[model samples]
Target chain A: MAVDHNVFITEESIEGETAGPLAGRTIAVKDNLSTAGVRTTCGSEMLADYVPPYDATAVTRVTDAGATIVGKANMDEFGMGTTTETSAFGPTRNPADPERVPGGSSGGSAAAVAAGEADLALGSDTGGSVRCPAAFCGVVGIKPTYGLVSRYGLVAYANSLEQIGPIANTVEDAATLLDVIAGPDPHDGTTREAGADSDYAAAADGDVDGMTIGVVTELFDGADERVVETVEAAIADLEARGAETVEVSLPSLEYAVQAYYVIAMSEASSNLARFDGVRYGHRGESDGNWNESFAETREAFGAEVKRRILLGTYALSAGYHDAYYAKAQDARAWIKADFDDAFESVDAIASPTMPVLPFELGESLDDPLRMYLADANTTPVNLANLPAISVPAGTADGLPVGLQLVGPAFGEETIVRAASAVEDAL
Target chain B: MSETPESDADTADTAAAAAAAVDAEEVRHVAELARVNLADDEVDRFAEEFADILDSFAALDEVPETERDEDLINVMRADEVREGLTQEEALANAAETEDGFFKGPKVS
Candidate 1:
């Protein structure tokens, strides 16, 4: 089989021992996840030749469950861009439409599953990375509640806001992958003790009878008309299957994108400091002083990464700290409050996964802010630290539109149940 | 605590001033702090980009402060020792290694 998509940087098939939950399943792990003896570049030239010495927790869990490791998938450079175009290896083409992007930074994981290169794939979601690609590629992906999956072996990028998630061809498959990977690790201190052993596969009954779903108005504002209509029709189909729908307002969502970028970039600035030339990846041949050598070596970073680091440094600077970072924290809290209030009246909130359809390659690369705004609908879910799933709702023209279902913290079961219904509808 | 706040006009002016605050000099300063080298043209490009990006983030100014930070608590683990990467494994990916240690440029 010709693998046309620029999906995998390294390819191998290591089958697990027989008789486990993921027996015989093939999975492609995003390159950011450490694979023992495999080159995990994370789509950055700085680590183009770097190979990890150990496997991440998620990798261990899946392999132990009998899933065959297929390869290391591509991603945005250090998971910085909305499109995989920033990948030093090259952009991953959308399996659905090769001309357009496979929304990133987990685009390769989604494309791998969509193209049948892998039965399921592992991807990380730092502010919609996994879900956005899943939406654009017409697959199912879930960003589990923060701390549900251990981050021990995954390379850090905006650590506080990211979780390793599963991308699969169906809701059940995604949940099954989640079951194999979701748990607490002594190594990753932030992982909680709940939902580690929950049987997520059992939640895919596809029955949303009497379940109340909230339609977020702010998420609908400024969204493409076709995308809104497609999502609305999907909800109506859910309502026809005995689900109640209500219009809910998360007024603070207007500020969520801003808050998400500030917080993510700030955390990224600190987390990425360990990439100095002495420790890992590429080292420059500079004979200058230590500071100059370090700075010169860091020049290998791509444009988007540099922009974010600079912006993050600015936000966390002394005089502007209270004005930018502090305000973002307050906005995050308010958005979380809004979700908490909405969940009381509804089982889960629903919105269009992405505010717009997938654009062509290099279309939004020139203006970074325009690309950031495309994440408005999805960032709120990450900010609130809730579980969410993106399922293919319907099609706009020939492109796929994803309908997202977000639930209360540790509420992956609710999200899976509702998304399963959406899966059936589309 | 009951003192009157700024008027809407004043807030608008303040927002505009804050939006324009990220100039080329600020971009250079931040790049230095981040320890990432950028060329002169790149600094000018980033300064323009920062102006637009930061302006969009100004929406956070209107959001009221909440008590979320109070809810955050550091989770403590038992002081039990666990197996970690060995010396060889830790240094496996390093670019320049000396006798059992990673080497870097000499500090002046």
Candidate 2:
């Protein structure tokens, strides 16, 4: 039997308490997200002993809406890897195949949902973290428009790109979770002011007839044959349902991974700088001065975390600032602009959430480049700050494959509607 | 951005040498800035690994040009001081507190 990776933390059962909206609906939280009084470790030894003082915005919203936090699910240390193998707590195995990895850094959440341990989960999407795992685990995951959900309590990975989103067995369930947590908050300044009142669940059943869908040409060309075949079938299904599929070009799409890594790592380096021994979490045990103690504690962070900090530090380094960091930001603007143009004609863009299915644990664990490339198809949406969802298209060799639908900023309603249609067809 | 030869090398070495360069001292510096502590062996191991991993960053030099007009704007808020947590609530999570302030290990 596959070891259950579900239910990390659960609420004490209250007698006669009818299950809340999420009553009896078990939920798992990604380790990177803060859970008040729970061990939210971000799947790293550095924070193994740390306990958050307050709930993350999503956690508070979900729990308040009657969703129980089963436990902190495993993730890449500080949300860094595409494979959950980087987790200090150990890699979360895919329920489909125990030897294969559950995609990460939201792998645990996806695996929990896949294994039927939880009805739903909350995962942070920073450059496809949520969607990749969902695809690998054959579940539905949504990465809402940037700032759609509050980041006040989310342990920061990349401030501009990361968003708290839902992972569930179906698009409607994911949409339901999004409706509860999507709103403006004083804690997160970047939240969109215009769409604060939108009801995502209500929009799920909206008309898909006559809607224009874009097929990103770049995503399909070099992707795994089986994954592409699955997505192509989804596009065909949409066409049969009266949705028009158009080939839309995002000229700047090629540079997305390059720009995403620079910005994310740069922000991560700065954000993670606050984790030195003095504040919280594990501190180094060295006897030297404050500097040595600080070094010792940091060294304890996983390889992925350290790599990002250094890359970020170097990107922000004085002389190279204009060359690398500034250029990436400019590219980010262009990517956003490309999306704006593409959305002018299309309701949403469809692609395979992941180019390939889940691989065995340790397969890509040592190859960081290969792992980073795993997120290539999904990272562009984050750079454009758009809403996207991964709905299970079909099973390939008994493994789940997700077809991604990406919409313009604040276009959650459209994506949700389209995704719901896709889910129903499957 | 013009690509540098060293940057190309950095991308090629992303998996190996990049992570191998990080050392204990560098980890500590990053930690102090990040506010987390690590044990000594961790520092040494992470330092080497992080260095090897960071080598991929060299590819940033190879990216095409960026728009000069693009600048980051701080999404601003009005300068209004709202009521926040009281002294008691603010100190509630502290390991030690005195006179509504957080108390820490004694400083010389």
Candidate 3:
């Protein structure tokens, strides 16, 4: 099939699929996820013609639960950037405001759900990719606890941080998709053992009374006024519903983005080594030299991808490994420790998912440092291997602001319960 | 190199020299290791970009060294034989494949 250049990569509708559990529903997949017999580009020219023989566990779950696999959505090349502008394909525009970017690199998945092209979409959240876009697009997105969902077929992007999650219009829909995808899978060894007995959808309606929610003091201090106000209002709504709110500090939060980048890029540099243009996808027609062809093919990758790979390689290089990568790992442990200590006091932590609202498409593309800083508030959850949900709190200057609910590692049940109360209040 | 003999008028020259000290060859070597080919122009471009990036990373030098005491376990599971994909299933979507594995141009 000739791929559509728009948000969807394939347009074929599945026939004979009745309105079952998710019947009459259509879902789009982020391009980085493998969809059997479908072109999974990862928004890279290197994989422009690649197709996967097997489906990602999340994609299979979504389809088997009666949702139609609508298409492969675009993303930042290998999920490296904050804006969809980094996509090898042209950027996906925010359905609400065409001139502005749909926040990335799961921008297309979020936009597809927002634009009503799909009832729901699957996106990988490695840092803020899913949630930030969902916030920008006024949708609900969840990054399940690390190992809650199998990563067996999702294209690797910082393996420890990435999770295939759902993007939907409402918290209930997101929960339903989460129920379908979150579980133990032998295929991915890191999947949590506790995933076997938990049904996320059931936990979505669990009681919220007596639940103590902590407000991360650092998230609000220097954030945009409107963003803080919206999240604060969401907290008020939770308080109205019998949830207690308290202030908590995570001093290490200040260093999360820095630590996140070093570790993510370091892993990315190693993970992306598989796409050398020889074994799969587009092999450059070099002058019959194997090494030269590999080089030529990689040269075809976009600038952002190359930049991340280089940064990662440098961080993981010998001599500097202890200083950068290892130190970042230690910082990850400290960040997790901070979250653990706070969770001991509260059932969950709430914060504004991102400090700033969505900006224009090309606004941060040229400034790499500024772009890296955008994931500041959300990266800690990944570092802690915790479950977090970004639900629409309200709008600020007409753009949505996400109120993030974070819980302890494998504490998805508590987080989901708290999020449901917040959802109900909103 | 005699530390380049610093002088008040030589500040800009010193900065330029510091930037130039970030080897273009090293940048290319890193790029090769990452499996991303760099054009000669990109090598020059990235060398400059990486110099600035490394300058920022130099901040880590200020961080007090910490003990290597992390409880990070490899977290491995007991290896067991399990249900697996058939060779036909495994090779089903390869643009090209051979005897139970993906086939490609020979690597030198």
Candidate 4:
């Protein structure tokens, strides 16, 4: 059914249980997450033919919950790019509009859900991979707190910032998926018990009475006027439903993009080092020289991936480590403090998920800086290690606009309730 | 280490200086360090793009001096034999293998 959208890298059905919480639901698994006996390419040539010996913990949990596996969804190569165009496979066309790109690196997952190819999808958000595509495709995506979901079987992009999240057509379905996949996994030690046994689906009651939401001024500034207006109208609807909105400022947001990139790329450089063309994946011609072969093998990476790895290597190099990497970490700490301070006064903070609307394919490809800067609003939440949800608020110029709600650490239910309220209004 | 800038303008100045630190040679060197083989065109293009990227990171100069949180938590695991992927499963995806081992490029 989703074959026309270029939304899946591998389109095979895996059988599921007869009955469970997700009975009969179809799920699109992001290529970056491992699925046993299924090809897990991460949309890169190095891994184009690699099949995992094991399933990611999320995959196991979802399958056990009676959700049928629809296919391995396409992604930006190793989850590096914002738009899915960087895939070794071709770009996933946005189901909403074929000309405009589906925001990525989880473009296929969001596109699949938006196209009704799958009932739900799994995506990894290192920066805004999950939420960006979710916003662009006008679907609901949740980037759980850093340790809310297990990352054992995920192809590590950024160890500290990434989490496996869900994308679905509605707040409740996404929350239900979260309930199945959330909680502790022994395979992933980073997972804590905070979200263990979560009843997040029940929390999506669409009731926002007496809730105080912090409308982040920084997130709104510099955003497209149409998107801002659409989000503003959504905020008004929330107010009409009895939720209070206060203008809160996180000035550290000004530094979020740079800090997020420096840290994520640095971590990516380290995490991706395991693809040495030795143990698994693609191999280069030895030519009797090991080092030369290794370097040649890595040539399989696309331009964006190579650029990130190089920049990451530079940031962590001896002469520049302190100036780039360390400073970025300091900014991260400041961002965390800002969120901590904000949460002390308000229940949650809100922003437009993406500053602009769905990008026309090739629009931002030539300018990597423009693509990086576009992640301004979503990256702050990841830097702070907070939970965030992007729910389709409305549309601008016939494209989707998402309102992002951020909650404190382990506050999945709070954001779910807030997002469901938006859904109810819609 | 450079001193923290006193103002936004100073931060911009420092960012420019930092961005200027990169060149074609530096891009090539970093590519080597990253095990990526870039062609001449890529080196030229990346040298230019990397500068723009580093310049945008000027915001780092204004980051408050917060102590790095290095409170490490170790997960203690029982050292015991565990049932894991068999040798066949482990090498199932290898590009080349011999004698039940992953075959590597021959040493020069």
Alpha-carbon local distance difference test for all models: 0.89, 0.77, 0.78, 0.90
Superior candidate under TM-score, 2 versus 3: 3
Q: How many clashes does the backbone of model 2 have?
A: 40
Encode model 2's per-residue lDDT on A147-247: one tens digit a residue. 78888888888988999889999888898888878898877888767456667888778368999999999888678888898889988888888899999
In order of listing, the candidates' clash counts read: 0, 40, 0, 0
* TM-score for each model: 0.96, 0.85, 0.88, 0.96
Error of 4 at A43 (Å): 0.5
* Residue A365 Cα positional deviation in candidate 3, in Å, after optimal superposition: 1.2
Model 1: CA > 4 A from native? A1-3, B1-16, B69-73
DockQ ranking from best to worst? Answer: 1, 4, 3, 2
Q: Sort by lDDT, best first: what order?
A: 4, 1, 3, 2
Question: Model 4: residues >4 Å from true position, as ranges?
Answer: A1-3, B1-15, B70-72
Looking at candidate 3, what is the lDDT of residue A126?
92
> Model 2 chain A: which ten-residue window has the lowest total lDDT?
A7-16
Q: Across residues A302-400, which tens digit of lDDT does each residue of candidate 4 receive?
A: 899999999898888765777889899999998998998999999989999999999999999989999999999999989988999999999999999
Tens-place lDDT digits, model 1, residues A1-426: 564888887887767768799998999999999988888898998999898889999999999999999999989999888889899999989888888999999999999999999999999999999999999999999999998999888999898799999999999999999999998888888888886778998999899999999999999989999999999999999999999999999899999999999999999888878778899988878889988888889899999988888888778876667668889999998999999999999999999999999989889888899999999988998899889999999999889999999999999999999999988887
lDDT, model 2, position B92: 52
Candidate 1, B10: how far from true, in Å? 20
Chain A TM-score from candidate 2: 0.95
TM-score of chain B of each: 0.73, 0.54, 0.63, 0.76
